[model samples]
Target chain A: MSVKYIPVQWNNNKWKYNAVMLASVFAYLWIFIFVTPDLMSNEGRINGAVHNARAFGSCAFLMLSVILCIGPLARLDNRFLPLLYNRRHFGVMTAFVAITHASYIINWYFAFSPSNKYEALLFSNTSYGQLSGFPFEVFGIFALFCLVILAATSHDFWLKFLTPRIWKRIHYLIYAAYISVVAHVGLGILQDQQNHTFTVIFILAAIVVATLHVMAALHEKKHGDPLAAESGDWVKVCETTDMQEGYAKIAQLTAKERVAIFLHEGKLSAISNACAHQNGPLGEGKIIRCLVTCPWHGFQYDVTNGSSPAPFTEKVPTYNLKVEGNTILVDRHANEPGTYVEPVPLNIQGAAA
Target chain B: MDQAQAIFFAFQIWCSIGALIALFFLTIGIDRIDEDAQGAYVFRLLLIPAILLIWPLVLWRWFILETERDAWPNRHRPPRHAHFWVAIALAVFIPVIILVSLSVRQTWPVDFEPQKLSLLEERKS
Candidate 1:
């Protein structure tokens, strides 16, 4: 987080992440373009542009599949959370690769056509009325258009300007893009291929993506139901002994609202589970030196007042908390963002005894 | 022109107008609308493609913010069940599409007479 928005809030981790990502992408492209063809027999060889187009196209599809899986994977396990960070960079790179694929196709196939290249791309196959020979290029174009929009608005400035809700809604277009890509591949190449290897892989990839989403949804549904408080207006989160130091116990106020009650410095503090930036799950974060750091992007907030440190103005709503015997109860109602609330002292030894 | 070509032509025209609007909006209107965008020139350039695509909405929001700054409502709720349903729908839709396409696929006609030769004779020949 920053007071003034620069191009990117680059850090050591972002640099390392980009470096590894670029290296992997370059390695994949090189191996696919050069190594695979040499290993294959002469009969399996394809034209240079066509081979490059396939390499980049397949890589883009794989990257997008991985990008879609990251969110659900993170939800299923904490270890996958690192992949969630620098995801926008992954998305932008995938868009670049996809554009390269499109470029190769345009230059190779449509360059000699009488019409403009882009115009030819659209009108080359007008069999939209038929199911067998439908213009799958249109689907590819639509997906690319969606991807470009997403990549362009990926900056945090758009997040702040569009408001997180609108930003999130716009990003959901990725799902549409994914579906379009599935159609593009299925209708375009799957129809022509005599060999079933790629067809099986494509289908399996789509199934895996869909299955992971469904499983994650089920997991969330199982844990997301609102817990009824033992008393009115205050929800019993957990005993003092149950909470580990610097970690949080998440209380679901409703299906939509959640409170993160953190145990820090022998005291308990409750704040909104949603981070101010991108609404990342603050409940999953760890607190260090009185500041709770969001697991997704490391946006930090003071556990006591739910405000970020000086110069970083991000804030989450604070909740009033009281200790009764060994139990910690949080007020269901939240204070306004950045409101100061006294942390409840935790008697961990007494609770254990 | 065909329907597809007509639609493509219309989209091209829309984007042409959108590019012009995007230039003005990024330079001047963005600052007036969003304070975070103030002096953030590099990020504005990144937003060109999105602004070119959704220029109508951007212009509307810019106009609205001129009257009431920061009036856009923000929601921080966890995502709804729509994503799950969409995923399920696509899962069902994709396999069905693949099956239908394969079933309806056209096969080339063969116009040769049947050979009466046995495997040994065919091999020898």
Candidate 2:
């Protein structure tokens, strides 16, 4: 929403999000180190820093899987949007946990290599031709670096600088990174590890992530655009009663876009269906007083003008409406964003008749 | 040095050169992404050594300009039902992977010398 370089904006939800994240991270690490060993002594293999490294890696992988699920989950239900607000924090956590794992690996197994640890990690593992012993470390390295880039640019400042489109494009590297991580785990650890627990968890996580994304996508398609309106300059919306009081009836535009025509206070005014923030559907939201309060995060705009009330700068385009007979005909041509358009009174249709 | 050693060192040289090119040439697009041009350049400069010294793999990855659209409208490719079938296909496909994986005998390269060496160490009071 902002183009200027402002410091990190904190809120109650963000504070709660960070605190919960920190608690869960510490709890996971504690349990992995202190409790997991006692329970799996029969099957447990590695110990000390090496074991710690794997534990951190596993935690990072789980974090990434959950992080990926949040996006599609939010799309599936507006109730999940609260989780979406502070999602970048989760991404940063994943990167830090992953780096911790990488650090431990460097410090432990490769500490006493014949060559320098890094050179040995790269040149010593030249069995790239073999599937079982291939250098899967390369994939992990790529994923880790991508995570670093994503974490670095997660700031709104960067979002403002890069433009949302480019920023989103750059962040699509997350999918690439996720794939690399999957390969890293699948081909590297699971191939030889005797521990079936990690294998089961990995498989389940993969299934859950893939399944959630598909379900979310399907949910969107099911509620897709209604049939296009008629071709004349003014398109006929539903009869006055179809749009309930304080509710909106979404109309499909010529393109794939939509407008939300809200019925409020015995009058009708239409606004761009997409919220100024993150393109959440405003049509699904309710009208409070005369403001259309977005269901996601409660960003509101005046239904009369499609402008944010006093103090807030955000705005949306409004459509012109003129009630003719029992039908409410709305101009397909949208007014400029934040421009005021006098709402059509309910009596106008009655008077015309 | 054996012929293998020479070739290995040569591969390392190529990796080093590739890394250098990726750093300095992070691209003009980097500026367009951020409003603060100086800040963007500085941040990219900080990334250069990491892009170089961390792994030679970043040499190529750092320069990748191709972008994938996974956001709304474009997020659904072939619709969600298509993505659903893909998920179902993967679900069906996984058990076969496990079955095949069970057959491959693993010869793990385990070096327990670190543990062995620590066994006789005197305990601190």
Winning model by DockQ = 1
lDDT tens readout by residue for model 1, B39-77? 667766677888888888787767766877553123455
Query: Looking at candidate 2, what is the lDDT of residue A183?
Result: 72
Worst lDDT run of 10 residues, candidate 2 chain A, spans: A157-166
Candidate 2 lDDT over B16-93, as tens digits, reads: 875766445556544443344434443454444433433343323333422422233221111212334444544454
What TM-score do all the candidates reach, one by one?
A: 0.87, 0.70
Counted clashes in each candidate structure: 0, 4
DockQ of 2: 0.10
* TM-score (chain B only), all candidates: 0.70, 0.34
Highest lDDT against the true fold, candidate? 1
Against the true structure, whose TM-score is highest?
1
Q: After superposing candidate 2, which stretches have Cα over 4 Å from the reference?
A: A3-5, A38-44, A110-128, A230-240, A251-256, A321-333, A346-353, B1-125
Tens digits of per-residue lDDT for model 1, A160-254: 66666677888888988998898888787667665565667777887788888878878877865346365788888777777887888887777
Give one digit per residue, the lDDT tens place, for model 2 in A1-353.
Answer: 42233345578988999999889988988897788763323255667887788779989998999898887788777678788778888998999999999999877876785666665555656677876666788888899989987886666544433334445667777766876787787777777676577778887887787678667766766865464457588887666656577788886764445778887877889987876654456888888989988775577999888778766656777889877667767787777778898877785333212
